[model samples]
Target: MKEISCALRFMFSAEFWAMGLCWTVSLLASYWQLVLRRITGRCEVYPRSELPRNLPTRPVCIVTGATSGLGAAAASALSKEGFSVVLVGLSSELLSEAMEEIRKRNKDAHLKGFVVDLSSFCSILEFKSSLEKWLTDSDMHSSIQLLINNAGILATSVRPTPEGYDQMMGTNYIGAFFLTKLLLPLLKTSPVGSRIVNVTSFTHRAVFDAQINEDIVTGKCFFRSKEYPYARVYQYSKLCLLLFTYELHRQLNLDNKPWQVSVLAADPGMVKTNIMQEVPFSLSNIAYLVFRVLGLLQSPENGINSILDAALAPSHVSGAYFFGGEGRTLRSSALSYNTRLGEKLWNISSNMFFDLKLASQATSSSS
Candidate 1:
């Protein structure tokens, strides 16, 4: 009886110790987050009143994922600044509503919406052609000055697109890659310098153990041959964008092209967006509520500030990442910048397009 009593006592002691450690860790994390928010608040990094006066009479800004979240907010703000806004998204209903909202705020803003799902290469091709036709049709082919790659997806379960690429990677990287390439000429033709804002994330720090494996392009499976974790996949996608942003900036600046091309990345910093609400994970509900209590977390308004800042800033600081709309350092994984990996990713992406060359041919012929 004494032995059993001692065993029960030992078990109770272990449980108490475990509970204590958990609470301690949670408290420390909360404190750290609070400190981070305080530090970020002191950084006044947004370009609030610094819009250039020499802006063209018909300056244009293209904002993807403008149907919702920071994309919608940024597009609306740019329209108020008198930009001819081109909004891209997959939903016509949401697009229409967003257009109406922008018009209400800026009656003179030339607002247009195009429906394009960033998940499919074919749809992206169509969207590219549509943008080209619109530009040619309107004679403003040289006026597009800003391209904001803001559209993204966060799925609970890993699903492959019709193109055999992971859905997250397809929408976030491949579509964005093609869209930026197609719009290069238009950006080059801007009267003033042109800017490209790639909306990446702080979550990219989580990619310490990952790489841009060829499976991201050709293989029909993900790691573990099961549904990929949404957070992990999203982080990988952002890492790819981050690497591309750096590489593209280096190449463009090296050439010293006619137009001063600057590429900057922005992280909205835990914004109140529907992406979190739509994440299919079981713990996502608790995570959402916790973020809600954090005072430093971003609203959609705050989220747009960084994107707009990168787009409108006069001084070109190319190839830098911005968090919360100001210049910030990234704690990226070393593997993310591995030249060999970046080259591999680029080659895979290039080949994917080449493999589907026939579909592209059909698209151009139809166009």
Candidate 2:
């Protein structure tokens, strides 16, 4: 009887109660932000008409995956800020719809839609060519003030791209890497200092024990045969993104160019988005449902603030990881800070791009 009573006391200890209280308060806060504020339309930083206008003076911001969810929200906010916003996505129809939706809120908003499938390196290169052509046609060599690498996928099954690489890794990390590399000239030439915001996630912390090489090189680590869950694969991809961000920052500083470019990683808190649609009826789904019931999911508007914060931060804050809406710089995983690992990943990705380019050239010659 005494043992049972002692166990009960321990279970109800002050530390446990305090932890429970903190979690409850966090849930309530999330609910208020996601539900009440969103419904009231009070979540936006600027209303239509109040957003800045006049593209010549305003900065230009390029946002990938801007057709939906947090990407759309961030693009809209940037439009409000009077930036010449470029929305890049896979669907022309969705891009049109997204631009129209932003214009509905701010009729004077300057927005352009460009369709590019981030999962394909060739598609990204094509996008770069199209962008250059458009700029040339417009007689505009304007520096891009901000580039937001936000396109990503959460695949339930292991699907490799035509390049024989994991779809998730290709889209989430390599695509962004190649795109950023291709656009480095534009970013460097911007009249004002440039910023690159890579949208990462807190789930990257889950990759502490992951085999990074297998995941990035062959996608074997994420195979169903290995029993590695889809969620973990997504997390691993984000981990690679964070590493890329750090490495890019290092390279930018090394270049010592007059036009400064800052690289930042942003972790948007879990937001209500269609990203979860790919998850089947599994423990992941059950956990998501539990989070929803507990009011732990954030609104898309709130989720994007961290990204915006990173994009608008001062140049000195480069190589920093910002968290949630607060936009506070936080330490990422220890692996993320490993310079050797980052360099290795960079070399491997560069080699992959080189191999793809070689293959394309060979095929063209043969044809």
Candidate 3:
């Protein structure tokens, strides 16, 4: 009994350990900025009044996974800021409820709900079609100035999406990729500078242990392999997301591209949300409790401030990484800044997108 108890107490917790390490690193990563902000009492988020005077009369913001948690909080806040917020989620009912909740906050909130299952390529394509049609009908298609890829999940067990990819990676990274690419054209057309904010995680730094060579990122090695633990897989997905952010930033900021589009990644710190509902109950509960006691767990509204900082950032900070309450722009993991790796990942991901589109078309023709 004593031995069993001792082992149980010492049972390895990958998530807890990863989160703890991430917490320490993120603090050190942004510690100076945090102190500077405290001393200067500086705020980074641009209030509506500070937005460029030539803003589209109806600037639009699309937030994925807007039905709950950090996504929902961000959608609500954006709507209240007078942007025509498009709420994207997997469930129609929940999306409606989220829009209603946001409306309750601001009766005049301009909100539209679109059902999008980020795990399914077909579903995301359908959302793009529907969104474009609505924007055209409303005459606001070119007004889409912000895209927040905030939908993510942490499954306790391995699961495959309809496309035979890991569900967590699909929903967190792949789906966001498809959605952003499909909408990039509209964003590029915005007269106002457009911004794309990817909701990354602090655990993204945990991927340092995993060699980030071409094979690992290109999915020839570990990705989609069920051999890894769920927590590790989640970290991998976030790392890919951070890579995508940097890669997209480089692509859009090229001299040839005649549009002002900035790409940023934000780490929301430790927000207690339903995204971790499927985690081992006992372990997650204890971890959250400890963090709560330490005042490390923030609410969704507070957690989303980093994301908001990215959305509201000026056009100059294109490749910034917003973190913590101060919304200080900080450096991401060293691996994230590997231009060669990010370029390779981007090329592979773009090719995969084309391949998936061809396959989807073939299936349609056969039917």
Candidate 4:
């Protein structure tokens, strides 16, 4: 009884909680510092200024996962830069709040919200059609200067969407792929070279450990239990996303299209985002607490710099991978850059999207 009491006391004590929180924040801070140092050859948050005085006028940007965290920050930043910002997410309440915040920051800014549940591909398709129609109907048609795929989901157990693809892949890869494809025409309608930014992470390197077996892609792989760690599943999804980004860049370059559509990949240096809340267990709670205590960590605003830099940097060209913030080019994992891996991911995603379309059609016909 005494031991149990002591353990409970320790767990609940302010000192223990404070220490854990401090450590988590410090770890994330240190991680970001290291990344900035490597990419810029210096240690500091990617130093940036407000949008340049001579920047283009009335650029439009559509950003996913914008209700919170990196996505919201990116949209807010763009709003300040004089762009019409579209915030995408499923939460109507959050979307309203985000819109209000951006509105406050940019009084003349046109802020739109698309309530999208990215976990379902059908929902994404619905969003795509709605977005296209909305764009076409508005004066802002053909004004989209950038599309940022910043929204993501993390799940611990093996989960499948209604479309049969793994949940992580469905939200992170297939949804993103189809969204980009659907929006390509709108993106091309831009005045000049526009940008498409896909937010990825260093966690993608872990793909070497948990290789994507075919069974996993086919939904034949079962979740061992609900006890699986979310970080692992999240990393797998990012690995596939990074690979897909590389392949998409290659295809864009191969096509030699006249329009300047820059396909870029970026990672938000570690920040305190509630992304961990989706983890299956209580450890995620602990992790969040720890990160909150670390003063070394960045605010979401800091994390968005990389995505914004990649999107708006004047010098950036197509087919580049950028580390977020300062927007410098990054050397990704060798496997991510591997043509074979990228091709495999592309093939898998294409097939999955095809099936999703077929399934939707069959269901619609039956209904």
**Cα RMSD to native, each candidate?**
8.2, 9.7, 4.0, 5.8
Candidate 4 segments exceeding 4 Å error = 1-57, 218-220, 224-229, 279-296, 362-367
Q: lDDT scores for all predictions?
A: 0.71, 0.75, 0.78, 0.70
Clashing pairs in 3: none
Candidate 4: clashing pairs of residues: 21-290, 89-116, 305-325, 306-324, 306-325
Q: For residues 1-367, what per-residue lDDT tens digits would candidate 2 score against the true structure?
A: 6645644543455533443344344434433444555576644332112322333566778999999999999999999877879999989999999999999999999888998988887888888888878777666655677899999988756887766678888889888988998888898887657889999976676565645464445575555464435555677788889989999889888886722888989878677777766533342355456667865677899888778778777655688777646445556778889888888888888877788778877977999
lDDT of each residue in 255-367, candidate 1, tens digit only: 75622778887767677677755433333444545666755457898877767767776556677566545433333446656767667777777777766767778777999
Tell me the number of clashing residue pairs for each predicted model.
1, 1, 0, 5
Q: What are the TM-scores, per candidate, against the unseen true structure? A: 0.81, 0.80, 0.87, 0.80
What clash count does candidate 2 reach? 1
Per lDDT, the best of the predicted structures is: 3
Candidate 4 structure quality by residue, lDDT tens digits, 54-119? 425567788999998899888888887777788998799999998888788778778889898776
Q: Candidate 3, after superposition: displacement of residue 153 in Å?
A: 0.8
Worst ten in a row by lDDT for model 4 = 44-53
Q: Name the lDDT value of residue 287 in candidate 3.
A: 70
Give me the runs in candidate 3 sitting further than 4 Å from their true place: 1-49, 52-56, 209-227, 257-259, 365-367
Ranking by lDDT: 3, 2, 1, 4
